[model samples]
Each structure stands twice: as structure tokens, then as C-alpha cells.
Target: MTLYRATAPHGVRPSPNIWNHTSTYEIENRAVDPDGQLAAALREVASWRARTVLDLGCGSGYHLPWFAEEAAQVIGVEPHPPLVQLARRRTKRLPHVSVLPGTAQQIPLPDASVDVVHVRWAYFFGPGAEPGLAELDRVVRRGGTAMVIDNDGTRSTFGGWFRRGYPGVDPAAVERFWASHGWSRRSVDMGWRFTSRADLEAVVRIEFDHATAEAVLAEHWERHGEDSGGEGDSGLSVDYAVNLWWREY
Candidate 1:
């Protein structure tokens, strides 16, 4: 969603990738986040006060400000220049926040410097994310925790859409990879709720195929604000969960 942060031939030129759909991705970001589930769940585990944090594949730097509010310093590494620029612009006033152009596979951070490493949908979950994992081991300090949040494509309300989007993505294998690495998990529920039906439909269109998008838009998940049966994903209805995995050295 941080298309503005993309640079060079990749950022300068448009990408067919969903992240390139900055507008829809932004809508999805707002729609998917109901009550700050990920943030709240992370807070439940531990506090980040005065800690040095790194956000891998940080998008628009939306979280950098929050990290700055509590941590002594927060650094965001993003490969996309537009997102890097946008993140930079977003956290320009926050001295503790810094956004850099980078990727998870080849992190630019020094060894054992980060107290906490947080990555969401940014980290690639296929069979080849090992380099990123090794880099995670390299940058995170001892006793520090790293949380990698990926979509639970195995089962959920919107699970089918995710499966269809990335047909070969194996959720089970990803869990196994993290677990074998000695990371523990904590599942947190989250959902998507859009104020406008149009916005909801817009987000769905970008998330799935036309048929799938229309089908999702037509279903009434739960009783929303004003209307009892509306054409939008309801926060209370969708079964959203985040797998918070961590480890300590």
C-alpha cells in the first residue's frame, strides 16, 4: 500500500502487485484493522519502552510513530522507495523514527543491535524466507523477540480469498518453519469493517477476483452500526487472527 515509497524502475514504474495498488491497499489497511488487534496483542506480551525496534518491510511508516511513542528509537526498513519516502514524511516530526530503503532478505542492520523486530504481511512466507530468518537472528539482540505476522490462509471468513490469491502458499509449512525455529505463538482476532459500502466493495475488488469480490460484498457478516444487514465485512463477524511468534536467545 505504500506505493509512494517505491523507487527506481520498480518504484518509478507501476507494479502489478497488490502493494502497488496503493489506494486500494490503503483502504484494505483501514478496512482490515478493526480495533488495533495486532498492536494490542503485541502490547499484551511486552512493552517496548526505551527499546530499539526495527520494522521489517514497514509500509507507510504508520507504526513508526507508535513505536516512537514508546521506544527510545524505531527504525523501519522498506525496499520500496515510495513507501520509504512516505514513511519518512509521516515520521518526519518524530526524532526517534527512521525509515530506510531495504528488504528482509538482505537487511541493512548491524548484528545484535535490535531489541525487537516486527514484520507483518511484508515477510515472504514461502520456502525461501531463510535468508530473512538468518538476518533476523543476526540483527535481534539476545533476549529480544521477533514477531512475524502473516495471514492465516488455512481457515477463516476470508480464507478462501487468500487461498485463491496465492494458490501455492502453504500456511502449514510456514507455521512449521517458525515453530521449528523455536518461536512461540499467540493468536489475536482482528477484522475488517468499512464505514461505506462502496469502500468495502472497493477493498474487496482489490483483494480478490471480480466474482469473489462481489460474493464477499453481498454477504451480511454481522449487524453493523446502523443497518442490521449490510453489504460489508463486520468486525464482530469475521474470524480474524494474527499468529504472534517470538523467540529469545
Candidate 2:
């Protein structure tokens, strides 16, 4: 029951899709990585159990509770005021979980404050994310690990769609950017599974522009036919690939 706000935070880059259509974004969050492959990969690289975890750009605090279940302390930093309030309200009952108003470029926490920093689809895109990366270096302890989850626009069904939707993003250039920065990447194959076709459509619409959305949905319809949610069809599922970028501080 979270409300959406039109007023975006000043001096912070706004995520238009999520800021404008929050409920739909929530559905997208639920629909992503249903098998928990990303979570498994993250734990394999750096386990947050018993450590202080920081969730950067934790929209609506959806992942905060999950991190709170294991981490000794969970801190969620978000620039959007409304989202900050939502995160705080969501984690109000959790004594160890705290949601703070801050941006990745200028994190409010002190130096070497967190053990594990988890940033999923947030500010760490590629070349322009150096400031955020610097903040991570400052906040993460000596032995801490920082992980950034971003769309791998090289392979997978959704990768093709991503390339088509955002033609500006070069997968090779992004790879080089991470490699130059000394961050290791593990490309993981993940899939989006929605319970209903309508839900799938809604999620896709938000992820892409109208033309791209229509084209993607039409392609899906053509592949799976009108009755796509049937047993024979792949139903409301899409093969998505993501790069789990990590670096030890």
C-alpha cells in the first residue's frame, strides 16, 4: 500500500519508470529471479550473514527485510524522499534495520562502516558510476565486498530486447569499464516468471518504451501463440541475463 510521489529528489538522478509507476515496478521486482539464482550467486561471492549490509538505492525497501533476516545490521540508502519514507516504514519493526536518506555519490555513513554493499540495478551502470564506486570504497571495510547487479546486454532473450530498447548501451564497453576498474563479473542466467500474462505485460510495458513494449509483447505472442499461458507454451517467462559485478575492498 505504498503511494507514489511526483516530486523527485533534487540533485539526484530519477528512475522515471520506478518513480512514475511504483506498483508496477513492485510487480517487476517480484517477477524477477524467481528461482533466487542471483541470491545464490551473491552468497557464493560474499556472504552477508552476521555482517553489516548496505542496500544502495533500495527502492521501497523490498529487499531490506530479506537482508535483515541474516545480516547483523541492514542499512538501506535511497535519495528519493518518498521512497526513503517507504523504506523506513517497511523496516520500522526491525530493530537492526535502518533506512537513511542519501545518494550513492555522497553516502551519509562514516568510512569503513559496512561489511557488505549490495547494489542491484542502481547507480553503478558503467563509466559514469565512478563517484558511487568511490563511495563504496570509502564505506566498505578492508575485507568487505561490494556487489553490483546489472543487465548483461550480451546474451539471453531479454538481452536482445535490452539491446533493441536501449541501443546506446554497448555491452563490450560496459565490460571494459568494469574490467578496467578491477571488478570481477560473473554472468548469471536468470529468468522472469509471472503468474499471469497480464502481469507479464504490465512488467514489460514499464521496462521499455511503448514501441519496444508492443514489439516485445507481439514477439512473445507470436512465439507462444494467443494462449501463451497454457501448459505447452513457455507462458509468462523470459530468459534474462545479468552480470554480477563484485570487488573486494
Candidate 3:
């Protein structure tokens, strides 16, 4: 049974340039969740053993290996064909993992088939994700958990940049959307620390537009803590907060 089907919105998606440059996107992904706070947050809410895991928008499969380590079976679903191919390549050596070409509105999984559903940055934002939300309801069985790791761009130091980048995204409306749909949220701080300055610059480029990127770069150069892992010498990282929404149905 499928609760709701997913389809790409009429005109909103990451630019092809963004999708085409897969390596850059991966750098940004690595930088965003450097501390794995999202995973830890989900585990804190509920634990699993030999559970079935579904990673929506699994990208180039950067985190699949980690999930495969604990999950008895792991399935990664991504809409982009190239990314799906990349994800398949990433997991070729892991017998317990599989990658599929699909989207959130239409998760390529059976009804009530998964024990844990995990997504980061790639899923959830505001009203547009309602169908996808319903799909979650269908796939996550009773006692199962769905975790969405997205930035609470309303708070945190980088919040300003995020909010500015997407001015129309009302955080208030987003909170309402999730709450109305029977999901609960908890906020936690995570960090992203890159080992090299070049890696840091590459991440910034992927995250912001050219003008904003230039502005961010200049501002950072003027201020010394820019490359300091967003926390001075604390591994040169930034404190990122994510909203973990889950429901036991």
C-alpha cells in the first residue's frame, strides 16, 4: 500500500549545474553533517536491530556504508539517474545494500516494509512535501520510525545565510506543516570540520550562489574563525542544528 505518490514539482529542483557537479555536492553533504548528529539523534529517539533501512535521496551514497554497518538490509532511493548510478557503484561491495531510482512522493518500496526511514538535507522543507509525508506514513510500519535531518535555518550562526538564500521558505509555516501531519521534532547541534582549507572553500562554493559565496569568502577572510571548523580550534567546524521529526504509527 502506498499512502501518497511523489512527483517532481513543476519548476523547483536543484539546478542541473548542482546535480551535474556531483563531487561538489558530495563535499557539501560531507561538510553539512560532519558530526553525524542526525543519526545519533534518531538512535536516541529509538534504536533498531537488524532493521530494514530506507535512505531517501541517498545521493552518491556517501553514508550508505555507515548505514549498512548496522542495518541488516539497507535500500537507497534517489530520483536522479546519474546519482542513482553513482549510489549503486558506491554499494557494489556491500551485499546488504541496494540502490533504486525513485523519489520521495513514490518511494520504490513496499507498504509497511521498512523499520527505519532516514533522510538528510535531501528531504523535507515546507508544504510541497505533503505527498512525500504521506508516503512515509505508508512505508513506515507501526513501531517504525522516520527521521528527516534538515537544517533549522531559523537558528544557528549560518542561519542568516540560509534564510537569505531562500527567503520565501517560512520556517514558521514549515513547523506548522510538520506538526499538523502528526510528526514531532527535536533540535540538536552538530558540527562540520574539514581537514583542509581547500575542502572548506569547496564546500562554501557548493552551498551558496556566486555573489553570496564571494561575500561569505570576503567576510570570512576578514574574520579569522571562518576556517576554524565553525568553532575556533574545535576541529575547525560549525555548529549545525537539525530538526529530527518522527512518528510511531
The regions of model 1 sitting more than 4 angstroms off are: 1-18, 219-237
TM per candidate comes to 0.82, 0.93, 0.86
Query: Residue 124 in candidate 1 has what lDDT?
Result: 61
Instruction: Using TM-score as the measure, name the better of candidate 1 and candidate 3.
Output: 3
C-alpha-based local distance difference test score of model 2: 0.87
What residue pairs clash in candidate 3, if any at all?
5-105, 6-105, 6-106, 228-236, 229-236, 229-237, 230-237
As a TM-score, model 1 comes out at 0.82
Best by lDDT: 2
Candidates 2 and 3, the one with greater lDDT? 2
lDDT of 1 by residue, 92-180 (tens): 99888888887777788899999888887764643567777888889988878887777777666666567766677787887788788
Against the unseen true structure, what C-alpha lDDT does each candidate score? 0.71, 0.87, 0.74
| Ranking, lDDT, top scorer first | 2, 3, 1
| lDDT (Cα, tens digit) per residue for candidate 2, span 1-249 | 133234534336667767778898889889889898988999999998999999998889999999999999999999887788988998999999999988888888999999999888874357778888888889999999999899988899899989999999988888889899999999898789888888888888988999999998898888888778766436688999999999998
Which stretch of 10 consecutive residues in model 2 shows the poorest summed lDDT? 1-10
